[model samples]
Target: MNSSESNENVKEASSIEAIEDEDPTVLESSTSETEVDAANTSSSATEGKVRKINTETFIAEIFDYKANPTKWVYKGSKPAIIDFYATWCGPCKRVAPIMDELAEKYKGQVNFYKIDTDQEKELSGSVFGIRSIPSILYIPLDGQPMMSTGLSAKDEYINQIEVNLLKK
Candidate 1:
């Protein structure tokens, strides 16, 4: 990456870190930190589920990136997939069910999250540089995250999960 790109990445990293420092729940996918934690602890109660994420949780839970912005450092013990989407987007709607299914199918093997682009404009636009709806971010346990936009086939998503997230 060029200096400018690198600088942008640094800036994004710092911004996300700052968001975490500000309000932790601001990044939570649903309700608040407690609720999400509850869901995680008892994820079996809800099969094939996808959690919501914000700037704060994204940094703290997904990747403690602020701790080290220069490299890929995932925070969670399990792999995760972040869905960056807008509610009004048709393609996003199409991808929603697929995400839910994937979340359920992967369940204990992987953590699934959804980030509303409209609600999290800063993280979506500035931090993640999201320009479209249904931008999926695949985060492995030990590697840089990869982003894919638009609606993709279920099999494609499964491939990514198996290859990137599961590493199998």
Candidate 2:
């Protein structure tokens, strides 16, 4: 084989080696909401706060779902809200502060998460079917998660949280 072909082969091998060397436990712990929840529950930490979640964390903490194509199963102990947004989107920027306020108001009651759509394209597109910016997913303890796109009023978000998550 030529030198260029040999170099390509070495690059491929290095990539595979990198993947193999990653620690599964560390990866799981960081992304697993269950683990985080357990730790939080045992400690005296505050709740109802907002956090950033990636694809792994979404699967581990939020939904704990599998590759099943037909069923939706939520694995969280409390209700959750996931904001799907992009950095450059105006609507997303407008909704961010409102979400933060809501998180503070509902602290220790609900969980808030943000996913950058640009960074997590597969999760935004295939998993959540997100087609627009500032899409919010409101998940209750015992029902299907609802999705809302575009910018919404803070009152509207409050109403949804109360009705859907708080049930008050």
User: If scored against the real structure, what TM-score would every candidate get?
Assistant: 0.71, 0.71
Please list the residue runs of candidate 1 whose C-alpha ends up more than 4 Å from where it truly belongs after superposition. Answer: 1-47
lDDT of 1 at 5: 34
> Please, what is the whole-model Cα lDDT of each candidate in the order they appear?
0.66, 0.63
TM-score of 2: 0.71
Query: Which stretches of model 2 miss by more than 4 angstroms?
Result: 1-46
Instruction: Kindly give the number of clashing pairs for every candidate.
Output: 4, 3
Model 1, 9-104: lDDT tens digits are: 111222232211221212223322222422234435643578876677777666554576656677777888888776566787899899999887
1-168 in candidate 2: lDDT tens per residue?
Answer: 333332221111110012121212111111212223232232124355567667777777666445544456777787888887776677788998999898889887888888877666667766665656677788888866667666777877887777667987
TM-score for predicted model 1 compared with the true structure: 0.71
